[model samples]
Target: MTINLTEYGLKQTIQKTITATEQPRLGRVIEQHRELYQLITATGQRQAQVTGKLAHQATSATAFPAVGDWVLFSAGDDYTTLIDRILPRQSVLARGAVNQHDGQIIATNIDTIFICMSLNADFNVRRVERYLTIAWDSGAMPVLVLTKADVCTDRADKLRALADVTVGVPTVMCSAETGEGLEDLQPYLTAGQTVAFVGSSGVGKSTLINRLLGATVLATKTIRQDDDKGRHTTTSRQLLPLPSGACVIDTPGMRELQIFVGDLQQTFAEITALAADCKFNDCTHTSEPGCAVQAAVADGRVSLERLQSYQKLQREMSYQGLNSRQLEQAKIQRMFGGKQAMKRVKQRYHRD
Candidate 1:
């Protein structure tokens, strides 16, 4: 029953200086299935649900108890616990369609995100770029893990295809079945670290995680030859402890999300940097005479595909044709790119 919360990434700062709360229990959410939650507390794993008050006050799905979220709860009965508060998250992965105000939270407080895509037909560099945008924006380090190494031919060409979008990102190629090249993932799974694996359905996220866990805790379906995508096997988000003393949160097959403006800027940092050198501040990279991004594309510094991907994301999020309210949101993201940046802004405001 008794478990070490520290082993599950209970931050030292929260354990030390946080003031007392009305809630008597502290727990980490390890699994969630729609309305139901399974948590790890000092006593044991408890089935929990959020109080109506908590749900009422929650402005968005991002505020709810997601896998990897820490919550304060109290026993509602022998069978259930009532979650009162979801602790502040250091990092969060959220997704939604274009123009959505309250995007869905995928996971929270994660240290790293393993964006998996099969090296076979399921691999798409643009999709990787989209995942990278969300991962970079989530305040977690993004690592590209290419699964199904055994099935891949023309590996060099595939790797080359990924080069532009995956610049400065850690990438490892391995076959989940053969266990080849998984060793490269060990350095990220050190004690106390929490990594989240995310990709579309049947990209071998479960297979890869099962191999890492040394057991088949999660079910994996064979990849469909017709679509070349994995079957939708993982339905709920669950955090499992790795044998290496780290934890990993595996999510279900994900849909492509509308890009976050801040994430887009980070994901295409090279293009953003190039844009800064443009003679005209508002130069669109398309056919603009003074656009440095286009110049880079022309001169081989930036791949045209990467630029097109960036532009497409911009269009998806309405950044290119932003209205007044959307423009304000863009400004906010530029000012507060992440939580750390937001904190700095607040500190400066107080000082002023």
Candidate 2:
């Protein structure tokens, strides 16, 4: 039952950790079902649960091992394994937890993220932008995948709409039914690479993964004819290997994607660049005079819709439980000299 660890993206860094540790064996988490986990090692797949010490040390859900995390474990007596430690993640995709200030880990150690959206009734440019922000901040490349292209009549228009927001990010039009644009994803699906598919329900993430795996490994449900919304078929995160030697993590559909810790500047680069030319250092861009962002909107360089989207995401990030004082100080430091920046931030807080 032993399998090659290389197919699961075992690298020198993980090997070093394994070599350094003596008591625990190395394994990669393949599936997560609440507190239960399924890990794959050189021996084979085994059911696992985190050790009591590991659980007690976790302050939040994000601190626990996620589907793509590599961990140290020990064999238990009854065909179970005890996960002792989680190795450092190379990259992580996380988002703000629902109604909570803490972050939720979507997948860890992912090399690439596929932000899938159906070109039908489920398509939304703003949601895609939110996914891109988290993906960019995750230290992984984000590739936009437009699914159900066979049903969409206005593919060109939809691509045009995504052009300004997506910018340099690559977009691939795919149809699981017709196998279109599946081959274009091969470059990112190379052997030993891990990719996670994320989007709302009915976006065909499971279907796309099935097509890539060349088997119906993940369950999928039909979309409702009225709203085009599909039921949640994949209830939990699971990493499955493809015939191509790459691994794909299929996640449950996220209905609402709140901002976690991500770089707004990177997500909205066009607006960030424009802000540099603003008349005031702290121009809010709403009604500020000499606002480069507004000017661009007026001059047709930046769309009003895009600017509004940027402003909305900025507001979301601002209130996502990150230290407000630190955020202000960082902004001031970016605008003024160090000491003067701290002084200005204090004065601004005092004024408010």
Candidate 3:
């Protein structure tokens, strides 16, 4: 069967980036195992690596090709390929680590981000808020996938709890075993769209993806009935083409999501709207008089706990000792420029 690049998310916007001079081969990176990249071209799956110049020019790991990235490559001996450059990504999903300073690029050019959470022992509305914050900033739509719906006894209560925090975000409940509510996921899985499954461990990310794939392409580990801390079977990120013509990027479960940047405006829409009525434009919503957010909290319009959670996330965005502004500037440099921009910053600072 011939693989159609358009159906694999090679949209016209990305196709316009190709130049007649350098691009001899075009393919999407399906998986990156260390330095070797696995790409699916018009022919089939092929192994590839970045050119020495490309590798040398990269300033950080995120500058390299990630899964779901379209790349220009050249054919080599023994059927191997050498990647020349990565196309501009429409959307990027990344996370930060405590010990690690740079943000890790998990996937790129995705259409939707499925934030999975099991209803049984893994449900946390706070975590859902955190995920929504990160998702709203990703330039992709975020959908909350509530897994393990079959065994949940307090579905209504839990959903009611989540209603306030997940405002405007789509939520779906499905059971991988019973197949209930599985059809709800089909709308987002249409052709040419690439959706990613992401959540903490044992929330049934792989299981739900397997159900969507119509086969167990990924391994699943049974969750312990006690605390839903089961390990994920998929150890790395991989982009798989679904039979329906859409692509699915399966990622390893992230228990503690360290956010590099977030869009709290969408996640805390109610508070953001309330802040408009505040007497001060820069109201922190703490104890200031005429603070609209605090006033809303007093009248129960917004929960104090949720307000505090939002503030905590605001303070927590200082990833790896860099202020949020620094991290954002770093991201801008990674996305649009390279060593030249970094050098310019240093030169401007040194001149001052």
Candidate 4:
């Protein structure tokens, strides 16, 4: 098939770019069940991986193509060709990898992120904060989706709580059982758009997907009555196309969504905004004169607990961002020595 390169800034003509061995294909990742990915090619589905120079460049699994990525590769009878290049992503949804110090690309070209949370036992402002931080870092617009609305009491109260946490992002309350709030979510799932759902187990992520698909495409699990945590039903991240024309990727329920060290400033915009108003240029907001943040807490403009939460998150991020090989090394040496650590050291030395 002939392809145009004018939009992408290539000088080659459309017909010349089409090669016999290499073909352009629109493929969605059917399964990430194994280390190898099952890509749904036009001719048929094929198991593919990065090899040769590409494999060497992929420092982490996330560096390779992810589910929802449209790539160009050579087709074969037995073996699928390595993806030569990844098309520019419209958006990316990522989070800190489990137990790893780096970020993991959850999905690419996502238009919106459904920040799922349960109405019952798993409800947490802190968890939502983490999800928002990661979502903002991913460069995708985030929408808060509260599931199990049918079972929760005072549903309006829950929405208000999410609104307070999100501040600027959209929030919707929905239940798979009753199919509530599905219509509110439709505008974001228009044709050619992509969406991703992420949250801890028992937050009804799968249930919400099943409802949007208008069928039981994704498995559902019941939350424990005592603790309100749902058993994980989806084990791998898979992209599913909706009959309505959009695409959605369902991910495994995350037990621990760690934070990468550098996103602290972007995640808490409110706190950052308050800091700009402080009288002292280096005010810590604890008891500094003309502290805008502390003054906000005193005047009820901001909650004390909210400031405390912000401070706690900042500290956690600092700890995670330490450059030492180990926590003990950071404590004893008092100098983190990784690339970031060295940069800090140089900055301090050079400062007047």
Candidate 5:
């Protein structure tokens, strides 16, 4: 008798690389430990594991398969067969690795990125600009989803601000409660297509997904009145198959986003384009004789905050070297930048 992988939800499915172990096995990554990953095979759903060699070879997070990635792997009855290779990705959503100076894969093979933001205190055009740069660098199309439109006093004003920041990207305003503008999402979420949501918490990610699903597969929560930030409701990354023959991956809210140094230029296309007009080949846009970038900023063509954010990310990534010591320092700084004064006081007391 022949076994069919589809029956077991193990057929042609998108899965993330979890881990690779060599002591007891010799295969690569087939499943991930990210908890939110679901694997499909020719037979049915399968638990994924990896071989040790790939684990040893992974120098960065991007080297591993992220959510929305399709990989080929063998299967055993108990654990999944070791992964042999990661299939080609159509699109990827990545951010700078936390503490490490490398690029981390947020999700892979994404066809579209839903840039969600709330209409309340959570809205920040600077943040949207930062995200757009990374999204443009990721080789994926970005779609801005402004949620909580019902709460906003003037929806048009809020959307116009977002439109100004995102330039060429398509922006949509939707209220999960009223299902307003939900139909606008259908063009991208067609059958066999994959879409991923990238935004901070309290942006109505789960609420929107629940609306898209026509049911409540994902949980939703209310944000605190003071902070206007979601309660980090979606803790892990998980992909769900929508009834409309599309797939969606929802991830946890990120507080701070760092950009990979190598991709900064690609992400900031406007700056790079403007730099071409610079008189000097290596214009820093500060005090250069013919700095087109600075000229644009001066002329109000480019926002000063946007350029500064780009430069800030570049410097942060540059300082975060690949070495272990640099990585440790970056981690500590990221986790404790706000409490450095108190930290120093405590350290001095302990030493005394």
Candidate 6:
């Protein structure tokens, strides 16, 4: 069965690059295991593995093919495929890997991202801010989805509290059981658009996807009754196409969400705008007499907690940026050292 590439969000730029060659076939990666992939091609879905050259040339995990990536490959007679190269992506959503200073790719070529948080015990404004920072950096629109609304009693109060932190971003209160607030998401679910559902495990991400899919296509688990914490259900990422012509990618619940890189000022626009009004050009907003941000906190215009979250994310980004630069410098030094050693060997040979 031939599939329409445009329905999977293929753009003219990529369409123009497609060649009428038989050896290399074009397809979109719909599933990814540790080292294997499942691609949806014009012919049909096929299991694929990257070519040795691609694996050898990859410097990091991000260079490899991820779910939602378009790749070129060659098909084998035994129902296997060999991927050659990945096409350029229009947008990608990623976060910092746990216990590492490297970026972890979550989904690529995404148009929208649903940052899920349960109204139950899993809700945290600070965590939502963290997700927002990474989402903004991903070049995709972020929508906050507050799930399990039926269980929460203080819905209005919680929404009021989130209003201060979720500035400019849309928030949808949804209940998979009751089917409330799901229609509000229609604007983002237009045909040809791809959206990803991401949040910590047990936040009802899979449940919401099941509701949207109108089927129990993804596995889901209940949270512990005592602490209200969730267990891992969806172990890998998979892209599913809906009858509405939109695509949804469901990912495993993340235990930790570290920022890889993002536009800090954009995420905290309110704080940045206040800083612009400070009397000093370089006010740090930390006890400075002319700090407008501090003044706002003093007058109850901005919450101290929000300002602190902004500062904390700013520090993390700065530290990571410095580490990345240092890593590059060390790599360059190693390369130059090898050249110097080879030059010394030549000099010794001439002298002898």
Q: Pick the candidate with the highest TM-score.
A: 3
Candidate 2 regions with alpha-carbon error over 4 angstroms: 20-24, 76-79, 318-352
**How high is each candidate's TM-score?**
0.87, 0.88, 0.89, 0.79, 0.77, 0.86
Residue pairs whose backbone atoms clash in candidate 3? none
Model 4 lDDT tens row, 119-190: 888888778888887687565799999888888997777676665568778888888889888889999888
Evaluate model 4: give its lDDT: 0.69
Predicted structure 3: lDDT: 0.84
Model 6 ranges with Cα > 4 A deviation: 20-24, 76-80, 279-282, 318-352
Clashing pairs in 2: none
In angstroms, give how far residue 256 of model 2 lies from its true place. 1.7
Ranking by TM-score: 3, 2, 1, 6, 4, 5
Candidate 4 — number of clashing residue pairs?
A: 1
lDDT for residue 171 in candidate 1, whole number 0-100 = 93
Point to the candidate with the largest lDDT: 3
Query: How many Å off is the CA of 92 in candidate 6?
Result: 0.9
Summarize candidate 2's per-residue lDDT along 24-90 as a digit string, tens digits: 3888999988889999988889889998898997656676888999888986777678998776666
Candidate 4 weakest lDDT stretch, 10 residues: 6-15
Clashes of each: 1, 0, 0, 1, 26, 0
lDDT of 2: 0.83
- Candidate 3 segments exceeding 4 Å error: 20-24, 76-80, 319-352
lDDT of 6 by residue, 275-349 (tens): 999999778789778889999999999999999998888777623445556644433322222334345434544
- Could you tell me the C-alpha RMSD of candidate 4 in Å? 9.1
Error of 1 at 39 (Å): 0.9
Model 3 TM-score, all chains together: 0.89
Candidates 3 and 6, the one with greater lDDT: 3
For TM-score, candidate 2 versus 6, the one ahead is: 2
Report the poorest 10 consecutive residues by lDDT, candidate 2: 329-338
Q: Comparing candidate 1 with candidate 2, which one achieves the higher TM-score? A: 2
Candidate scoring better on TM-score of 2 and 4: 2
Local accuracy of candidate 5 as per-residue lDDT tens digits, 37-58 = 3455444455665456656755
